[model samples]
Target: MTALHDKAKGKVNPVVAVGVEVDDAGNLDDVVLYRQQAPHTYKQVKYTVDSRSPLDTSYLTGPSKNGGPSILRKVADAWVALTRDGAPVELALVTNRASSPADQLLAGRDARTMLLMPAAAEQTRRSERGRLRATWAQATNLTEPQLLMLLNVLQFDTARDLRHLEETTSLLMLVNGLRGDHQAVRSGADWVAEQARYGHRKIDLEMIETAVRDQELRTGPARSVLSVATLKPDPLKTQAVHVLDWVDRFDGDDAFSKRRPRAPFTWQQLQADVEDIPHHLGAVPQVALTGSLRQATAFLIGATLRMVTNVDLAVTQRGQLWESAADYDQATHPILAEHSLGIGEDLALAVEVATPMTDDVLVFLRTQQVPVDRLVVLQPPRGAKDNAISTPAAAVALTVGLRDQARRSAKGHPRIHLFLAGPMGLSLLLGHRWNRVAPTTVYEEIRHSVQYEAAFTINA
Candidate 1:
């Protein structure tokens, strides 16, 4: 598929051919992307239907079945042999398996290049990245420098499930003026397999074109996908037509850990970027959002891309799809229990869905001497907990109820200080329905601390 995509794009010199099963003794000889002037990329494809067990450091360093060499060991031996000639080459491990949740080392890998990011490598010796470097060096029988060098050229193309890969291949075929149906896909696969079986190790653009013509493939219309992300989504949906990447502005050490933007200017830049999406994707009725974003940021995005704009927004949360335009039973959903403090001129509203944050909000307000006469606390009827609101209907109902509560509670109040502790979906839903409310100031919790900071204010 890579070869076909490159050929269709008229990529010169760098990639001229692709090889399969070219070297029996080479560890990364399964599939090779041959480049004329640049480093050639050799890939080892590993597919597994088992979704329960993920690839971890233990699996990589442990012996394979029948006590064969470990996965890392084989790759290291291959790297040593290939680099002996002073030739710059790249190696990749393409797998459908996912990385382990507890695997710290593999967690530092960049989603796009699959290499350990520079930020990860530069961490302290006691950090997860450092431990990965040390462990892999010892396991591969290579010095730290050697291991680092190998890592620089090694890539991990993981989580490429067969279905997604097939879909991507079909899309690529269609975009390249070839038949994109399942039968066409099977034909393409058969053609490649026949070439390999016939001892034709290398295939060039002409061969690919001839095979396509002989197969009598058809072409279809083009399609596009728009992805908006603050943090890169793993196994980034290959279907995206354009990706607005803001990961560079963030520390790339660990995806699970909490970290702030690289600079204060990042937020402003993000706002500007979000504002430009409509112009960039003119007439596109829908956009898909995937990222690890702050509640404030999510709300801001929703407020910017309101329903009146005629662009639908969709996000995947907890394996379920939530869309701004999706229908819901507003009357049959979880009801929010609201607690109101003493009446005052200004309002302090704290919405806690994932966990209880009312106590902390109260402390922050009192300690900081925030001038507010009324403080409203809204939470689930039972209490706050994760997955408290499971369905989209519940989420929508809660957001609407919260909005109405705020308006009613702040009837005399001119300003509302908002502190939210909930899922991103709820935040976005609230922002989308935010209207006729008092001017609100949102607060963000400082990382690794109990304190809060004013992130931004919104008036809608």
Candidate 2:
């Protein structure tokens, strides 16, 4: 579907042919996409009905269930054979399984490139890196350098379920002026299966077009869903026909021990991911957002898909749905009570919606010696507490009031230090309405501590 989408979008040297079950001496030869004057991508698709098991380093390097070569060894051997002709090739392991949080080496794999990150690669003597190098070399029976070389071209395309893939393919068909209905999707799959059965290993663009025309598939509109999660999967994901998973990039065995992503870079990566949603879904008009995101991340997502964009958004907050296009009675909603402190060049804005955080924010400001000329606290009418703003209207109202306060109070300040202690929903609403303020620095509170760290500085 990705290849088809790229071709429809007129990608340079797009895939011209695809082969299924080709007689290649490699496990990755199940599916191969041939591009014009570019490296061909060989993919191995693995699907497990059990979602409990995740893909980890141990599983990848462990002996196959049938007692042949390990998964890693098969791919490594394939790489050696394919690259023998001095041609560049790409190998992919496409699976529905999630990545294991317990695997530190797997955690170092960059989500975008599917390659070992430079930072992670540099730590060769470190526990995870060293172990990865040793384990991979031993499993593949290859030298360290050879193992690294193979890994450079290896891609892990994980966390995509069958339903998601089907929906994506249907949507891609619609985008490419083909039928996108359920029947069309089933027909497409059946057609591929029939071709494979007949030993028609190679399929060209003409064959795909002919099949689509012969099947008489019709195009239709499609909606896309984006799921942004941290601690767990979002409940609203089940409501979507298909979902794009944007789980956290943190590495750890569990939520309590999860390692926070490095500031700025990880934040930027997340921003890039959110920004790419439109392109990924071929500019679907409506995008439903579901997630268990942190306040900062939620805010970032909202800011990236702000009100001015062509895409409309509907987000699930605390089990209630909030539509960006919904109309609300601004007068009936609760307004924030603001408190001001002594003035300075940099202003501190503390938005306390779920709980009180003024004291902690003040402590962090003073301890960190953040240059603050003034401080402004925006709280509920009574005060910050759990479930301060219950309704979507109230959430939007509070966000509007907070935005107004920030803009009015930040007139003389060059930068605003934003400290938020609130529901993720409120933060997202606030971010959607955030605009025309001074360069702002958003802070994330270090768990179990009063200290706050700068997570993202939004200059726009």
lDDT of each: 0.72, 0.71
Model 2 scores a C-alpha lDDT of 0.71
Q: How high a TM-score does candidate 1 get? A: 0.57
Flag regions of model 1 displaced more than 4 Å. 1-43, 46-91, 95-112, 115-154, 158-234, 251-253, 264-266, 332-344, 447-450
- Rate residue 178 of model 1 by lDDT: 62
Q: List the pairs of residues colliding in candidate 1.
A: 225-241
Writing each residue's lDDT as its tens digit, candidate 2 over 220-302 gives 32234566666444534433333545445654445554425633437567666666655555655666566556777777777
Count clashes in each candidate, considering only residues at least 3 apart in sequence or on different chains.
1, 4
How accurate locally is residue 342 in candidate 2, as Cα lDDT from 0 to 100?
Answer: 52
Sliding window of 10 residues with minimal summed lDDT for model 2: 235-244
Per residue, candidate 1 scores C-alpha lDDT tens digits across 1-460 of 5555454434454467888888742788888888776578888888877877788888789888899988899999988887787989889989999887677777878876688655446776788878877888889999888888888998888888988787656655654446666788889998989999999998887898788778887442222344555555534334454567666676546654433456654556766776676677667566555556778767776776666677666555654445666666663223444444554467898888898887788777777778788677777655679978787667766777777877777788889898888888778777777778888887767654547877667775
